[model samples]
Target: MIKWLEIDGQSSVAVARRFARTVATAAGFPEVRTEEAVIVVSELASNIVKYAGCGRMLVQWMPHARGYRLAIVASDKGPGIGDLALMMKDRQSSGGSAGIGLGAVKRLSDRFDIHSTPDGGTIVACEFLAPGLGLHPSIELAGLFLAHPDEDICGDRWQAWEMPHGLRLALVDGMGHGPQAAEAAGTIIDMLESHARLPPSEALGNVMRDYRNIRGGVASVADIDASRGEIGYANIGNIASMRLRPGEIKRFPTRNGFVGNRSAEPLAEAAAAGRGDYLIFHSDGLKAVGADMLLPLHGHNCLLMAAWLLENGEVLKDDVTIVIARVHGRRTHAENG
Candidate 1:
């Protein structure tokens, strides 16, 4: 599960620490690692409160390789740090405060990434992985699934996996919120998973044929072709899809129909996309404005970007799922599997 915290003071810092400890324990980290995670959380929260005055944090224990890891992302729209290299050293104070916070977080985390721009503020992402496992170096992807406020089962479902040519990601929101909707979502995902090797439009078309017996759901799929340097996107319903390239963000209009029932004709859009390009696909449970307002964060870690969007824009009335991914490094696509 993913949780978001609002941090502006010492008390919120304490809350963040507690959250870190809880997730660390739940993720089965050793005691020593848990304490280190607490320290990392405290330092991250303290720096945000002291430098930015107010910011947001996202925490969750997610699957990584064979084991799980705790992911913590802190974001704030304050004055961006200058000379981050100098600030990363011990005792390198910038705001008349102890200069060891960022350095300490980097030291304690198993993996870390930070991006701060004069215009985009700061985003710090860290992960504490379980012992005895290694991370895939070729590709990185992250997503979150949230059930409706009143229901135990989420009608929305999402998945990301690799193909021989590139990567395939999809999000499906079953017709409504409940058992029937959940079943429809399950059916659609099963169909998509079986057809993942096909193009986005063809995959959805497969679902359309087999999904007629079940309740229908909206679906959006994207195929990232590394060789072709293109992103092939197709949608069967109202799920929001965006292509964020350098200096520009493009939003695709919903195809305006369902997969099984009265669906629109299957058509896929292919656009040029190479390294550093990002794609975002989310269900309608999140407001459309959420993605627009967080455009400054496009340069941050994919997990952090996904969390920030959900934290601010969740409509709280339906199941919400958001997946964020970026294309980088020319590693072979099969390396990701």
Candidate 2:
């Protein structure tokens, strides 16, 4: 079971603290554990208000196969960090006053992941594992998944998905670049993620409603029934997508329109135009990696190939991110097993 709580406003810190205490008691966590969670949440939530004027907090508790897991996400589509590296350093301060707020957030969580783009926004995630539980080594072997940057404002973003329905997927490239661009990208991605189980077309429509909140953006949603060898999809804007099988690469075309504005055509109309074998998504960064190289990988290796192309290919000056998912084992049994 997944429990979700979203809180907003200046009192987000207080709300997070109260929620943490409630989660702790319900989950049977120690008092100290609850306090630590609340403190970290407060610090981050406070940063949201100070920096972004407004922010959002999402807290989720779910049962992992190994044990229970807690996730805290705080996001603000505001002026992004100019120097994320320095900001993360324990002694560094953006305003010249030193405080261990972010550092404390790091120390308190079992696993931490942060992504920020100069033009895009920022996403900070904290994962708390039940004491004494261990993560599967195989999961770590995949490394921390990250998107490749494109030239200037590359509006693309992606995340891997595994679901009961099959291998679900998404690719979103916000309308433009910078803070607004990031907001669009994040909004689209978040919507698809929320309805990952729905058909690609249906999920796309759901996200379309929120696109206005970000100004405008383009997105594609796809899901592969690996057992059935079928992949369904919907797309809009210039965000390009493809499917790579063992030796063949297939491209999905996009219909024109910015995300935030409803053109003469409906958002679903663009989505209704389905295309993809498996699926690969790219912002304008596709020009960097030759279109020919898109489908070289046989299975899971596709992700690595995409990463290599983004890093080595000259076409990127903006943020570049590509996602490739296969209905069948993209890797050999021997390789994955």
Candidate 3:
């Protein structure tokens, strides 16, 4: 599960550390690794209190080739670091403490990245693998899921898997809110996972065929070719899909009709997605404002970006699910599997 904690003051640091330690333990991290994770959390939480004054952290468990990993994201809307190079140096402390926090975090993490803009904000993302686990290069995946206020289960679902072409992704929003809606959405998720080898259009068609007896929903699917810097996508109903680059935002149009009930064959389309581009897919539960606001957070950690959107932009009237993915390095044929 993805968990979020707010960091506003000194006390919040302890809370954040406790949350991180608990999650690490639950993920089966060894005592040594869990202690390291706690230290990372303490340092990041302290940084938020010392520098940003207020910020938030997101912690989640991610499946890896060898074992599981702990993914941590810390973000703050404070004055951004002016010289990241200097700050990362081993004894360089901007907060007057031993300058080893950020550096130590980088050394302890299996994967690390940071994005900051001078007045915009700072987001630091780190991943710690389980003891004795080997690490593999991977595409970053991050998203948020929220059930409708009146329903116990969310009708929206999303998933991603590596494919021979690159990566395959899908987002589905079941017709209504409640248990029945969740079942319809859940079935679509299962179909996507099982039939990931099929092309987006064909796979979507298969979903439509299998969803005959269930209440229909809107769906969008995409095939990302990181090597070619392109994305091929198709969709039906109101699911929104978009690509955000440095300054430009491009929106993909979805064909009208519900997936199972009444739907037209969605014509697949292709577009350019460069190294720093962001691909976002979400259910209609998000309003235009919420969707538009995500543009400024283009290069941040995918999970942090999704969490920010869910926390600030959600309408809360309906179930919401947002998936954010960023194209990084090319994956080899072996890694693609």
What are the RMSDs of all candidates, in order? 4.9, 12.8, 4.7
Worst 10 residues of 3 by lDDT: 328-337
Q: Which prediction has more favorable TM-score, 1 or 3?
A: 3
Name the candidate that leads on TM-score.
3
TM-scores of all predicted structures? 0.75, 0.48, 0.77
* lDDT to native, each model: 0.76, 0.56, 0.75
User: Taking the tens digit of each residue's C-alpha lDDT, what string does model 2 give over 1-337?
Assistant: 1112234565656877788668766777787887887777777777776666675665655333255656676666667788877788764666664445576787898766565556545556676666666643222111112223332333455554665535555667665555666677877777777877677777776666555583677676666554344556677777676655445555666777755665423233221111223355666645634445554434333333443444335554454455544333333222211
lDDT of 3 by residue, 1-337 (tens): 3335789997988888888889888878889889888888888888888898998887766543245667787888888888899887765777788635687788987767777777667878788877776643435665666678777777877777776646777888988988888888878878867777788888887777666645877889998777766788988889889887766778888888877854467657888766667789888788754435766777676766766676567455888888877777553342222
lDDT of 1 by residue, 1-337 (tens): 3335789999999999998888788777889999998888888888888888999787776543245667788888889899999788765667878545677778888777787878767888887778775554444567766677778777877776666656787888999887788888878888888997788898888788767745789998888776656778888888888877655777866776788864466557877666667788888888775435666776677777776676556466788888877777474443222
**Candidate 2 C-alpha error for residue 334, in Å:** 23
Cα error, residue 84 of model 3, in Å, equals 2.9
Separately for all candidates shown, the number of backbone clashes (residues 3 or more apart, or on different chains) is 0, 19, 0
List runs of model 3 lying over 4 Å from the truth: 1-3, 62-69, 98-100, 129-139, 146-155, 175-183, 212-216, 227-230, 262-264, 273-276, 289-319, 329-337
| Winner on lDDT (2 vs 3) | 3
* Best first by lDDT, ranked: 1, 3, 2
Candidate 2 TM-score, C-alpha based: 0.48
